[model samples]
Target: MSPDQAQAQGRLHDTDPVGIIDIGSNSVRLVVYERLTRSPTVLFNEKVLAGLGRGVGVTNRLADDSVERALAALRRFRFLATQAGAETLYVLATAAAREAENGPDFIREVQKITGAKVEVLSGRDEAERSAYGIISGIWRANGIAGDLGGGSLELVDVRGEEIGDGRTYPLGGLRLQDAAEDSVRKAEKIAADALDGCSLLDGGAGRAFYAIGGTWRSLARLYMFETGYPLKVMHHFAIPAGEALDFCRKVAREDLAGFEHIDVISRSRRALLPYGAAVMEQIIRRAQPTEVVMSALGVREGHLYKLLSKKERARDPLIAASEELAILRSRSPRHAGELADWTGRLFEVLEVEESADERRLRTAACLLADIGWRAHPDYRGEQSLNIIAHAAFIGIDHPGRAYLALANFYRHVGLIEEELSPWIRKLATTRLMERARILGSAFRVAYLISAAMPGVMPKTTVRRRNGELVLELPKDIADLDGERLRKRFSQLGRLMELSADVEIA
Candidate 1:
């Protein structure tokens, strides 16, 4: 059924779907998202590096070849988006589309080929939107955001919802590369000179430098491989200023082709790497940010964020996505809510010191605990793991992602001999890993008693007594006190390193 119709019938899909076209200087791309939330998940994505800005710097016009390629991509994008059941397609044209002399003509052609609404963003407009993307995604970011596109660069100061004035410069990668004639030193000089007037650099000191755009993400990926970083998720990936400066300097000075993990660099993106680095080097020197935190969201997400109400923007993306999944797939949504609160009490009784983030993950796990109930009994754990691992979840980092997957996996199937891969182990800490095991054990006990049906969990009372964890079942629900339930309760106690006692009252 269509997603809208399904939702109306109280059968929600795992995700909401929307589409956007990013028309930039270097490429024109189409991104279809699973939903529009603080954390968006991509359902389908395609990009064509049309080099629309290649000659614009010198000739002040869009190249004929690039124009044709962009238009062709747009035509295909409309059909693909429609077939994907996207409710809206937001076409955002950045620097090149608004800067080049022939930009207007190109936009007209695009509008004709694809009858979707188009937005041509000025540099300031792009900067503000980029800030909104970061603000909406991160918990509470207080930093200077720099988004490097092919045609222009945007810098803005953002803290929560109070966004400072955003400015746009012509120091974008492709534009700077052309102006510097491929000289790394010259590119550095141009970048430094451009930032001389940006007062936002001063406020960024000791704060984060939230890097946006694809080039920064690619750079983060390279850094991840080089360091053997345990978690490879790019969003919220942080690097100290000193380390980032060193990396950028090397990229600016040498060819990445000679470096290790160079294979990660795409051909279309390689030549522009040095230019991106040059921009970074200047931003680092001027801002002296405490760290550089990479953001996967940008102008497109910013546009989406703008459309959201204050209440929707306030909801944690991870929690909202988890709750939505449960409502759609779980037999009883009320049970998920009950499990979350039950686990909270369990944690408090055990005196577990779960940080805010840990608590959030634990609550989400409870909501998603029964996602694989319909799967084959023998493979439900594996099925649930695979689904949650790659699901359209955002906000949670890769390590945290592993924690969620493992917790849900063991929730159904016991922690077997060696189902977890080495990579998964590396994704979380010893503490986080143990929490998963404990949460899984608790889920085991809860399910063995309630069978995941509603009303029974709330009737059960769990409390910590003199050197033991006691579970008191109501006399009315005494039918749940089966041998398997007893065994599972004791197993949970063993996992928690305490004796478990169950009694009917």
Candidate 2:
């Protein structure tokens, strides 16, 4: 491989894109991420449900039909990987391949066809990856990291940050349903043996069972639908422990027609819902977590995390990445530079006590604050939201950072959405909202001041006057556009709970 290609495939730290193809019993997926010093951009992502393990458990071999379907998908993935400029292909195979007789031959054929070697993961490796995925996304929990795949289930004990004592069982939904009841029980016992006396999980007893994998996520979606959660946010939605158990109970007894209401749940998964629910219920009973935090960040993010840490160091990778992207795509780099300098100076003069990351995110917001000018002048707010919402920004998480960016952009165009309130609420703390609002309002003032004469700097500083924030304009500024500036300042002052005034000779 060339140096550039080598770097792209090497690791996320190398500031190049990387591709990962995960071959599981139910589906085949390929993801290409453009990794930067702080963030990762998803260049391409798609999945196909090959059901590679549909009948592998009973047959003890991958069916000829399944092999053909998987091979075709792999070929398509190869094309996409190359198109994405991905230098390396990391292929991980789960249960079906590990248990099937023809699995080895299939992997070899794939290597010949796509020149991408497939690594058939042991149940342990699969469990480890699942644990890593959970840890990298959510807070480290003292409990079992469970991932239920189509053909098998793996559980790993995670204590603090370390995940150890993993075991893979053949009693996955598909496999368990295929086997005799006695065999299923036997498989459960074998799985139970792996966690027989692990201490890490002892702490989790009566706490939450941090649920990971498609099965539990499907359940969470069902719960969200039932509860009427406005947004389909998965990363931080905490389903009460009792609610999760109740949902499991409902799924365990519900018939096929019952799941039709869930927009994302498929008919194919209907048969497995009861079994998957049962698996979760059992785990929940064993290593109880405080609540089930549906992890939106998992294996893919785990791989990305491993890659990013290998890159340059940053206090918060997520924040750093967002800042980098904002700077890279900023349309007015020069204006953004000026805005940041002025904003920094203003904050310093005001004695703001926010952390570096908070300051950085604000600076980033100012940089991309004017990107909407590229879109139609009338609907720049809508255009700005779309750009930040869907941009393939290297190293930034979608929604979270995008919301912060949009909040700033909307200030320039006037806020008009009830929908954005939920997103603003997801910022973990209300203080974040307050900060964004203050910065956003300030940006609006700066934008208006700059709109009249692009580079004209305000002569006076902003300060608390009586009960309002008032801008003290320079004599020349007051003479040129004093009234216009005063009106703007009064509007902002009232909105931000302050007063406005200007002193001119």
Q: lDDT tens string, model 2, 1-505? A: 3566555422344444678888888778898876533345667888887778877778888888888988899999999998877877788788998888888898898787678777888887787777766666553355566778888877777664587777776757776666634343444454455445545556666555666667677778887787766455565567777778778867766663656566568766666766677766656655666676666555566555655553343334444544554445554456665777677765654455677656666666666677666566776666676565544333233334644555655565654446354543553255656556566666766776666234555354666645656566666666545566667666656555556665553
* lDDT tens readout by residue for model 1, 55-118: 6898999989999888888989999998877867889999988988899899888888777767
Give the residue spans of candidate 2 off by over 4 A: 1-16, 35-38, 55-59, 135-145, 155-171, 180-200, 205-211, 233-237, 309-315, 324-329, 333-368, 382-406, 413-435, 450-481, 502-505
How many clashing residue pairs appear in each of the predictions shown?
1, 13
lDDT of each: 0.85, 0.65
